[model samples]
Target: MMDQLLLALQGLRRSRVWLSIFRREQLPQTEADWLAMNRRNFFVHILPAKIHKGSTRLSYNWIWMGVISTWLFVILTITGLFLMFYFVPSVERAYDSIKEIMNSVTLGRFMRNMHRWAANLMVFAVFLHMMRVFWTGSYQKPREFNWVIGVLLFVVTVLFAFSGYIVPWDQLGYYAAKIASNIADGVPYIGPQVKQILLGGTDLQQPSLLRWYVIHVFFLPLVIVLLIGIHFWRIRKDDYSKPVEYERGRRD
Candidate 1:
């Protein structure tokens, strides 16, 4: 029985059906073949087959803020999803649910801590990434629109953190959200209406909780993911700005 099961698993691993679903149709047989396969495959195709050595230099990129930001986002997503298993998005039960997670659920406190810290780190990471881009003149000419998209992404990242802040229904989150909503209300023209829409009325309560939960978990994730895809797609198309030496060498 064990031998039959092992054989079955091995057969499935090499089967065309399994390969089609999990991997590219073409199997790479050599170093050259692997590089070509990346361009041909749907998933890996978006990534550049080759990157400039100067562009990837640690001195030029300095800890790769953009990549770190992306990793932090991934961490936040995983930790947040795990946290949701124990979280209730209602005002009455929300704080208590958090308490239960910290006290009762195995590894729940760790996940919550990871989510909190990742969200905080992402904000700084993204800001630093933008600064690095600006410092490197990566936003010049052809990359201007990409910079705009990055700014929008930064905004969306902040909104995601803010929206998630109230999920615990703690006094800190509650008052902070109220202050933010009031600040929104002070904006020109649609300020009052925007505040009304956000709070769902005059104050932050059940409606606000539901709205924030939906925005935090669903809408903002969709927007950020779409924008991130576009950002990377453009990188593949334009390629990131090269080091100053490369630019000078090309010009010469």
Candidate 2:
């Protein structure tokens, strides 16, 4: 039975339809084949053809926080879109729209909660991932540029959270925006201009809400996605950083 199953699966993999989708009849079995396969496949091309064993260890990587962060971002994007269908960005209606979503829309509360928590967790996970890289000396030499990119990504992630935090326009969100704009207003030379750009005025109001909504839903997502693509490409180019090892009495 097992033999028959294996033969049938092999035949199916070689079928014209499968070949059309996968663009290959069989898995790569040699170095040249692997290189050709990675080059020919878009998804595979983004990933390393080979990875260091140390890079895969849980102890060294600390729970794969980078992957977790990426998955959480995905979750937030999906749930945020679902919530957007019911959310109104208008200051007057924003809070009520949130209420309606919670009380009336199907699974709305669940998705909103998922989005909220995922946003929070993404922030946490990204921070931990950065720390892990720093401690593991993964930011050295050829990876310095990627480290800078990662820092930019972390900043943008924080901005993503902060912008989304103000969308509901409730008292909590309103005060949060007020505080943030005030901080922006304290920048050394461009304080007022910065605040103006952020709030669209001197105070938090309709325009502020609308601007943040656009930023949270559109601008930030675009920036983060671009940054992530670059970061991944850099990883593939530079190769994964192997964890440092120490002997009891000697250092290599």
Candidate 3:
């Protein structure tokens, strides 16, 4: 994945994709080396020579952030699959299956809670880590594209929340769906059309349940996986990010 990202960027960089905006000499590297980065940027370009070679290996923290997010995604997938065993999309059966999971399925209650909490924590952690990266200027210069990738990851996190919100089928979930559908209906000229597509009519009913389930169980997860691949690829392509100056060598 990282090799692919590098190759893509290598093409872009060679073509001087940011020529008009960032300018040739504005970047700290020699233009020829960047022509295809067939010439690699030396450590001297970004770091002092005194640092040991091993210090530049990898960021265990960023890798761990990705690992934790990946783990949460796997947990959500497994728990969601188990929940599907009992779940029915009909409004009547939706809430009942939730109750059944809570009461009847062995350890279902704990699994549900753990899945839910992990999801919430994953969002929070991603936000905090993103903020940390931003404040540290991890998104600078050659890394601007990866910063865009980071923003997309944030969007995927929200997508997960929106898709997962409808699973319980309680009064709260029902109303939440209604409100969300109404927002979908507010998409300017396409508002009503979007609502019609999502709701399958003017009101929430069977079609709405099915639509949300398809997005939740299949479509959105596939998109998330694609975005994750891009995210990890960017990390490797740009090389590990540098910690903030104040936090440098502090064991982040």
Candidate with the greatest TM-score versus the true structure: 2
Residues 122-221, candidate 1: write the lDDT tens digits: 9999999999898988887678889999999999999888877776779987987798889999999999999998898988889988887888899999
TM-score of 3: 0.71
Residue 134's lDDT in candidate 3: 77
The per-model lDDT (C-alpha) reads 0.86, 0.89, 0.73
Which segments of candidate 3 are over 4 A away from where they belong? 1-63, 244-252
List of clashing residue pairs for candidate 1: none
Mind giving the per-residue lDDT tens digits that candidate 3 earns over 25-87? 335475554543322443333322234333343552444465677788888888878878877
Candidate 1 lDDT for residue 205:
80
Of 1 and 2, which scores higher on TM-score? 2
TM-scores for every predicted model: 0.86, 0.87, 0.71
- Report each candidate's C-alpha RMSD, comma-separated, in the order given: 3.2, 3.8, 12.4
**Clash count of each predicted structure:** 0, 0, 0
* lDDT over C-alpha atoms for residue 2 of model 1: 100
Best by lDDT: 2
